[model samples]
Structures are given as C-alpha cells and as structure tokens.
Target: MSAAGPSLIEFVAKRPWLKKALTPLASWYGNAAGYRQLGLRADDLIPEDNERNLQALSRLPPKEAYDRIYRIRRATQLSLQQKILPRNEWTKPEEDTPYLSPIIERLAAEEKERDQLDTLGVLKKH
Candidate 1:
C-alpha cells in the first residue's frame, strides 16, 4: 500500500532493468510536478485532511514537523505572491525525499493490522 492505494514499488524494485528504466522518468516527473520549484518537497503536496495523513503528521519528530510546516507556509506565501523560489532555492532532487510517506505507510500497515485483529471471531456450530 502507498499513499495512493496499491503500490507496485516492490515489484518494480525487484526488476533491476525496469527500475533502471523508470528511475530517470520518475525523477523527471517529480521535477515537472512543480512542487520543488516552490521550495517544497514531494511530501509537502500530500493533503493534511485525511486520517492516515493526520496520524503520520502527528508522528513526525518535532523538528521535522516544524520544518514541514515552515515549508508549507512558505510555499503558500510564494503561491499567493505568484512567485517561485529562485533556481538555486528550488528543492533539489536529493532534498525532495519521502519524509512523510514512510510514516503514512507505517500508519496504513498498523490500521490494516488492527482491522485484521478486530475481525477475529470464534467459530460457532449449531
């Protein structure tokens, strides 16, 4: 599972050739998505309204959470001003890492586990 439902990340990773082929395109898409231009990481684009995302946001380390908020507020300010960060100030490829996603994935896994446990029922025979 990913932030966007079922993920093929593991499957793609297991295929070296396919992963290699896709890596550049993925990078290109990430850059083209435009969040980085606003000095925001990929994770900053995730909506904060959902349960899993809210849980993930809460679980982030204090400094990391603070940084995330700063980035978002800055981006919002930039957006309202109809401006983007200067080229050098744009989020670099290496800096656009998945800070929130791993936590979200973990939360999703925990929810799945809890649901599985809650569904347990004793057998009854008539």
Candidate 2:
C-alpha cells in the first residue's frame, strides 16, 4: 500500500486493454476480500498505524470520521457474533471508493516535496 512499492495497478492502468480485461477480475477480488460484507468501506480496512494514515484519518470530515468509527465498531461486533451485515447494509461497489487514499496521496506528495526542498542547495554563481 506504500507509494514506494511497485504497483500492478499502475502497470495495468497504463495499458487500456489490460485495464479493461482486469476490471471485472478486480471487482471480483474486491468482493472476495469480504470487507464490504461487514458494512465497511475498503478504506476502512487500511491500517491506521502509519503516520500517513493517521494524518488522513485526522483530515476526514467530522461526519465521515464518526461514520468510520461507527462502521468499525459495528464490524467488530458482527465479527464477535460471527455474522455479516444484512444484504442491504453491505457496502455497495460505488460506495467502496477510496475515501482516504486521495488525502494520503496528497500528504505523501507534500512530504516528498518538503523533503526535496530541505535538501535543496542554492548554488550562487560568482
């Protein structure tokens, strides 16, 4: 999930044919991953132990933050009960979009830019 790693998504996305062919398989895999079954969005499963994820979580709107917490708590209760959410409560595909990823990417880009600036040396032409 780290931006530093090589991404199959990036590779596939570069080629239209590959992306088109894999779209359905990717959808199937997401469903197979089972997070949506518990009423949690895909972003909800992202590990929040990292600095970037923490920052992203902090940036979420108040309502979104509350919803995320509620979802996690509900999912935990369901897990203990050994039950999935009802069909109507499962996160739909359209609702499973990355809510935190954009923020994380923005933070990562800012961090990268800051690091670059920190190392920048001004060469004075005599």
Cα RMSD to native, each candidate?
2.2, 1.5
Model 2 off-target regions past 4 Å?
1-4
Evaluate model 2: give its lDDT. Answer: 0.91
- lDDT accuracy of residue 117 in candidate 1: 92
Candidate 2 residue 49 C-alpha distance from true site, Å: 0.9
* Model 1 lDDT-worst window of ten: 1-10
lDDT of 1 by residue, 17-87 (tens): 99999999999998898899999998888998888899899999999999999999999999999999999
Listed in order, each prediction's TM-score against the native is 0.88, 0.93
What is the model-wide C-alpha lDDT for candidate 1?
Answer: 0.91
lDDT of 2 by residue, 95-117 (tens): 99888888999998899999999
